[model samples]
Structure formats: structure tokens, C-alpha cells
Target chain A: MIDIHNLDIDMGRARVVSNLTARFETGRLHAIIGPNGAGKTSLLKAVCGLLPSATGAIRLDGHDLTALSLRERARLMAYLPQERAIAWDLKAIEVVALGCADLSGEDSLKHAQQQLEVMGLSDKAETSVFSLSGGQRARVLLARLLATEAKIYCLDEPLTALDPAWQRRVLEVFKSRAAQGRTIIVSLHDIGLAAQFADDLWVLDHGRLVANGEPEAALSDEVLRQVFNITGTFAEGRNLRIDPQALPEHGA
Target chain B: MRVKSLSLAGGLLISGLVLMGALLIVGDVPLSGADYIEAITHPQSLNGEIVWGIRLPRNLCAWGVGAMLGVAGAVMQGLLRNPLAEPGILGVSSGAGLGASVAIVLGVGLVPFAVEASALLVSLMMSAVLMAFVARFPDRQALILLGVGISSLCGALMALVFNLSPSPVTTTEILGWLMGSVENRSWQDAALCVAGLAVAVGLVPRLRAGLRLLTLGEETAQSMGVNIRHVTLIGVITASVLAGLSVAVAGIIGFVGLAAPHFVRALGLRDPYGVIWPSGLAGGVMVLMADGLIRVMPASGDIRLGVLTSLIGAPLFALIAYKSAKSWA
Candidate 1:
């Protein structure tokens, strides 16, 4: 379980994430949804120990986050940022091997290879990372994260450049991992995709969490209009869907 | 990763030895293969002194300088995380060149022991100064700019030395040293190169964690338990020492360090430590071959070692750049 309380972050006088408090337990998929200037990515970065917060307490199973060493935090939560720039022509297998450095022996390699197979990247084992396409590189790096086998997975803008098929595939992978008792937190932009898949949604507007709950409750029309200022209607589906209508004729 | 690829380093070692043997073989004093064999076996003879003192020392100097430059270049590129980066990119080599040039023109006896030491000192001082300048900068791009500025300053100073040399002999000597040459190198010179290379290679693996983590970025590496400042300081200093030592012995040979590691990386070697030895061996062979080309060239004036290496290194750099450019697009 991860719990953050009243977190205030300052990066050179800019509050990327301000006074945000949230709780995330294992065995669930939590998506952070927000407008353009929202601090969704910053919030996740703070949780993963990549960014330090100025005020508040972050606890992992009741222990303070500050007390944890980087290697320890890395073991507890694996993070994959939005953009990846691997500057070398490292083989796919070697790239995956890096994720297992904290582990030991055949167990690590075997587990990593298994994760690669699970991600459908086993065939490209010896290929260089530079040889992979955008989607493929994402999956390959995602496979690297899987190899870590951490209790929590924190990701930022993972679906940005992915095609719809990849978007679905990646979401399904996240669902399976969450189902297996791993906590997954992702910052996503596609509201409809968020509506269709996320177990819980936290909406942010300008560095503050505006609403937090199930997709139905959190992405309601009133909250969307008040926080995002979008004149959109929420539709009932398996999950909440936004049926955004055209601007009223009189407005022109 | 392949065992065969690793053995290429071993092959390079053998080739360096053979080149050394051949360097002894085809000098101005033409000795038959059997006669050359007899010189080592019969040490009391005058041929023994010439073979042991003149040719063998030169061969060792070539091997040492090559290895030092190769390893130094590898470490620098890895530390900076930029392939175009070298010890001289921070003005270490150019500073060494300046020191050596000043010594030559002013009739300062840089001679056997003092020249290499003085050159090493000047280069080390310049690297330290660059580090101080870099520390004030918050980003990698800014630090790189400082390095370029320092390099430009050193280059201008180097050009000034050439312009002011009173005699043609003094000018030619400075040009040869600055352009990179291993002529008339004594055992003392080879020892300096060997010592610097040994220290650099020995110290690189300790910085392996920092080096591997550095690829992630400075803040990331620091966040991962690496003391970024210390690791960078040690890495650059060791690199500067090796590069300075190379220049002290063979002038300013370029490319072996840049090319060998790139070739090894291209062949799929991943571990930084694994690349160090092979790159060193490859560097030695590359330099020996370039030097050998000069000896065998039917030209009137001596073709400089630095010129030949740039001839080799510059093309390989272009190919790498072109390949990376296409792939990135």
C-alpha cells in the first residue's frame, strides 16, 4: 500500500504538484487524468521517489518514504517515464538485463526472459533497441519494468504515441498485472480510454486534484465543467464515457 | 558478447607484438631476420645495444601510447556520454601540446624524464581548471560549451607557439611533436605511458557504477546512490592523465580511442569494463598500424602519426554520425 498526504512540491518557485493527498492499495489500476497543465506526471514522480516533496508524508506500508534508500524504493516501486532515450545500441536482451541488476543469478535472467516472452518480444531478443519502432521500444521497456517484478508500477504518459491496438494491448497488460496484486498508477490523457478501463480515476487541474473516485463519480459533467471548463455530458457505459457535444449555436 | 569477439583483443595484442618486431626489423639499419634474432640472443654484440635501445624502446612506446590513448578516449566518451568527446575536447591534449611546444622553442630541456612529466602536469592543470568551470554550470550543454571554449584557447596558444618559433629546426621539431610522432622515444618515455595507462585502466572499473548510471543523466545517477561529483572528477582526471601521457610520448595521436570502442560497441559489447581491455588492445594495434604506414610510406618527409589516426578516426566518426542520424530520424 502507498499513501501520500498533503504533498507540496516546489521546483524553482513553480508548484508542479501542490497539496495533493491520495491513497493507493495493491491489486488495483489507478489512472491519473487531468487537463494540460495538471500535475499528474509530477504526482506520480513524487510517489515513485523520483521527485522530492516539500511538505507532507509519503509512507510505504507505514514506513516513511524518506527513510528508504533509492535501491530500496526501486525494489518496491518500478517507474517508467514518458520518454526514453537509450543512447547506445544495446541488444534487447541486455536492455532487459539492466532491470534485473538488483536481483541475482539464473532466477533473474529466467524471470526477465519470461517477461520478454509474455510481452511478445522474445523473438527480438538479440536485436538492438535502435532497431525497434516506437511502440516496440515502449513494450520492450515495459518488459524491462515487468522484469523488476516490483509491488508497484508508476508510469507517466505511457500511451502518448501508441496506436490504438498498442493502447489496448498495454492497458490489458496493466490489467493483468493489477489483477495479480500489483498496484499500477498511470497518468493518461485519453479520457474515453480512461473511462473504459481505469478502476479509479483522479482528475487534476493546475497542480491540484479536483476530483477522486470511481470513473462515474469523478468524471461527472458538473466536475468536468467546473474543473476542466469543458461543456461535455457524461454517458453511462460499462465505465463512464464523455459524450462531448458541439458548442451552442447562440455562442457564435 | 561472443567469445570470438573478445578474442579479437587477444589477436590485436599479437599483432602489436609482430608490428613491434617489424618496427625493429625495417629501420635504417637493415638487419636480416636471423641477424635480428642473434642480437637478442647475443647481447654482448653492438647490434644488441642498437636493437634493445633504439627499436625495442620505440616499439614499446608505440604500444604504450596506443593503449593509453585508446583507454583514455573510451573513458572520456563514456563519462561525457558523447562520442565526439575526448580528453583533448576539454583542452588537456592541446594544453600538453602547448607545454611541449613552449619547452621546445625556449630551449627548455624537456628531455627524457622532465618533458613527459611537465606535459602531464600542464594537461592535468588544464583539466582541473575545466572541471572548476564545469562545476559552476548546472547542465551538460553548458559544460560542453566551456570545454569547447577551453579547447579553442589552448589551440590558439598552440598556433601562437608555431608562429613565434625562431628557427626552422625548432619549428619542425615542434610540428612533429604536436602532430604526433614516436621517433627517438626512449624506454623512460614508454614507462611513463605504461604507468599512466595502468593507473587509468585500474581505476575505471571502480567508476563502472557511475559510468553505467551516468547514461541516465546526472540527476538520475545521483539519485541512484552514485556520488556524481566524485565519479566524474576521478574519471576525467584519469582520462586526462592517460591522454597527457600519450601526447608526452607520441605527440597527439587521435582516433584510436574513439574508433576502437565504437567498433567494439558496434560488435555488441555492452559492459564498459569488458570494452576497456579490448579497446586498449585494439587501440595499440590501430596506432601501431598507422605508425607502420608512416615508416613504409615512400615519402620524403615523415607523415605524422596524428594525421594518420585522424585519417582513420575521422572517417569512422562520420560513418557513425551518418548511421545514427538515419536511425534517429
Candidate 2:
């Protein structure tokens, strides 16, 4: 379990995440949803130790995260940033294999290949990552993240550029990884996907954790209307789906 | 795959050696195949003096300096993640040049060894300053612009020293060194290059993983257990030291460092690890060939090594820039 206590993230003079307190349990997918500029990325960055917090503590499995070395933290949790432009023409497999930078073993390549296959990129393993489409590249990067085999994952918009089919496949991959008792905290833009795949959803607005609970309870029509100011219907059935109707007129 | 890359490295090394041999045998003083053998066997002969004292040292110096520039260029490009990054274009050469000019003007390099040592020190300091400046502006275009500005500033400083010097002869002497040449350089220069090269090559294995991870960008590399700031500092220092060695030995031979790695990549090997050795070999070949051409070329005045390298390297640089621009478009 990962516990964040009163986390406040500041970017220069501006406060991005303020007094954010949350706990992420293992073997469950926790989704962070917020509108644009809602400090979703900043919060995720702080959780991954990419951003420093002046007035909070992050504990990973009872150990203080800030006290750990960068290498130690990196080995414990893998992070994937939102911007995904790879600067080199490395092969897809090579990109994935680099996730094993801290690992020194003979089976690293095999593990990387397995992860590539998990992302349905086995065929393009030898192809240069630049040659792949944006969606394919996204999958390849996902494979890189998967190759880490870390205890926790902090992903920011990992679903970008993925098609609907690949989106489901990626969520399935995350679900399976979570099933192995790994903690996952992901910031997502798609409410429907979050509602469908995530075990719990945390609504963030202006850097505060507005609501946190099971998706069915947290993503109610009233909360959705209050936070996003949109009319939406939520139903828990055989085929889970959330359809947002319209943005109400101002002050209506 | 590893084997194939190693073979390519081997081929490059063999080709570099052949070019060096060709340069050694065919110079202003023509020697037959038998005379070449005789020079090697008997060091006391007249032919031996020409071969050992002049050709061997000059060619070795060329090889060492060329390799240094090439390796340094590859490291810079990988570290900066900018194809246009090279020691020459990024003001590292000019920085070393300015440092050398300072040493000469101040009479600090009254001894030849002191010249190289001063140049290396100043070059490292300049690189650290440049890196610090670059960190302020993270954008690519801003970095390039800063390099240009810094390079011009170094050039202006060098010119200022020349203008202020009391002796016209010193100005004339420094001017020739500024143009850069491997001519009349002795084994001591070659030895100095080897020392610098040892420093450079020693830092390579430490940087290899970081270089690969760095190609993915700073954030990702850091996530993958790379200390981005630390690696970049060491990388810049190493590249600066290599460029300093080249400058100390041959003045300011431009573009070999910039063009060599690009040349190697264009030929097929794209891995940063694969690029390092072959790039060094390509650099050595380029300098050897340039030096050889100048030796044979019939010119009214002295042919400067810097001019020849720039003549070839500038066009290559232009080509790379044009291609990169087109790709971006």
C-alpha cells in the first residue's frame, strides 16, 4: 500500500497540488480523473517522486519514499510521462529492453520480449520505434513500462494515441498487473474508461482530491455535475458505460 | 547483432590503419616499398629520420586527434540528443582555441607540455560554463543559439588578445596555430593526445548506458535509473577534454568531431555504443586523408590542416542540417 499524507506540490511560485491526502491499496487500480489544468500530472509526478513536496510525506509499503535513493525508488516503481516523443531511432525491443537498466541478468531480453508480446508488439520488435505509428509507439512504450516489473506504477495519460481496441488491451494489461498485487495510480482523461476499468476513482479539481471511492459511488450524477458541470448518466450493468449528455448553461 | 556491429568496428579500424599506412609511405619525400621497410628496420638511416621523426609522429598525432574529435562528437550528440551538436559548432573548439591563445599570449606555454595542460584546463572550465548556461534554456533552438553566441565570444576574445599583444611576430605565430595544423608536430604531441584520449575513452563505459537511456529523453532516462544531471556533467567534461587535446595538438581542426559520428550513423550502425568506436576510426581516417591531401597538393603557400578539415567538414555539416530540416518539415 502507498500512503500520501498532506502532499503539496509547488511549481516555482505556484502551488499545483495542495494538501492532497490519499492511500492506494495494492492489487487494485486507482484512477485519478480531472479536467485540463486540474493538476493531475503534477500529482502523479509527486507520487512518482519526480516532483518534490515541501510539506508532505509519501510512504511506500511503510517506508518513506523520499528517504530512498533515486535508483531504489526507480526500481520499486516505474513511471511513464504524458509526452511520448522518443528522441532516438531505437528498435521497439531495444526501447523495451532499456527498462532493465538496473537489472543484470541473462533473462532480461526474454522478459522484454514477453512484455512486447503482452503489448501485441512482437511483430514490430525489430522495427525502429520511429517507424511505428503513434498508437503503436504508445504500445511499445507501455511494453517498456511493463518490462520494469516494478511493485508500483505511476502513469500519466498512458492511453494517449491508442485506439479503442488497444485502449482496452492496455487496460487489461494494467488490470492483470494489478491482479498480481501491484499498486497502480494512473491519471486518466477518459471518464468512461476509468469507470469501466478502474477499481476506484479519485476526482481532482484545482489540485485537491475532491472525491475518492468506488467508481459507482464516486462517479454519481451529482458529483459529475458538480465537478465537471456536465449532465451524465452512470449505470452498472453487464456492459458498463458512462455517457455524458451536455454541459449545462452557466449558473443553471 | 553484436557480432555484426563488432565486425563493422573492425572494418573501420582496418580501413583507418590502411589509410594511415598509405599516408606514411606517400608524402612530400617519396619512398619505395623497400625504403619503407628499411626505415623501420634501421632507425639511423636518412630515410628512417624522415619516416620516424616526421611522418610517424605527424600521422600518429593526426590519428589520435581525429579519433578524439570523433568520439567527442558522438558523445556530445548523444548527450545533448541533438544531431547538430559537435565540439566545433558548439564552441568547445573555439573555447579550447581561446584557452591556447591565452596560454601563448601570457607566455604560460613557454614549454610545449604546459601549452596542452593549460588548454585542457581552460577547455574543461569552458565546457562547465557552457553546460551551466545551457541548463538555463532547455529548448533546443535556444541551446544552438547560445553555442553560436559563445563561440563568437571566444573568437572575439582571441582576436582581442592578438590585437593587444606587443609583438607582431607573436601575433603572426598565434595566427598559424589558430588555423590549426598537425604539421611539424612531434611524438610528444602524439603522447599528449594519448593521455587525453585515455581520459576520454575511460569515461565511455560509465556513460554508455546513460547515453542509450538519454536518447529516450531526460525524464524517461531518469525513470530508468539514470542520474541525468550527473551523466550530463561527466559527458560534457569528457567531450571538452577530448576537444582540448585535439586543439592542443593540431590547433582548431574543425568538423571532424561533428561530421564523423553522423557519417558513421548514415552508413548504418545507429546504436550509441556502435557509433563510438567506428566514429573514432572515421575521424582518424578523415584527418589522415586530409593531412595526406595537403602533403601532396602543390600550393604556393602553406596548407593549413584546419582549412582542409573545414573545407570537407562544413559541407558535410550543411548536408546533415539540410536533411534534418527536411525531416522536421
How many residue pairs collide in each prediction?
Answer: 0, 0
Q: Model 1: residues >4 Å from true position, as ranges?
A: A52-57, A103-108, A231-238, A246-252, B2-5, B33-38, B42-45, B130-139, B163-169, B207-231, B266-273
iRMSD in angstroms, per model? 3.1, 1.2
Candidate 1 per-residue lDDT over residues A84-137, each given as its tens digit: 766556667666766775765566667777878877889988788878987777
Error of 2 at A88 (Å): 1.4
Clashing pairs for model 2 are: none
True-vs-predicted CA distance for residue B46, candidate 1, Å: 3.1
| Best-matching candidate per DockQ | 2
lDDT per model vs. reference: 0.76, 0.82
Model 2, backbone clash pairs (residues 3+ apart or across chains), number: 0
Mark the 10 consecutive residues where model 2 chain A has the least summed lDDT: A236-245
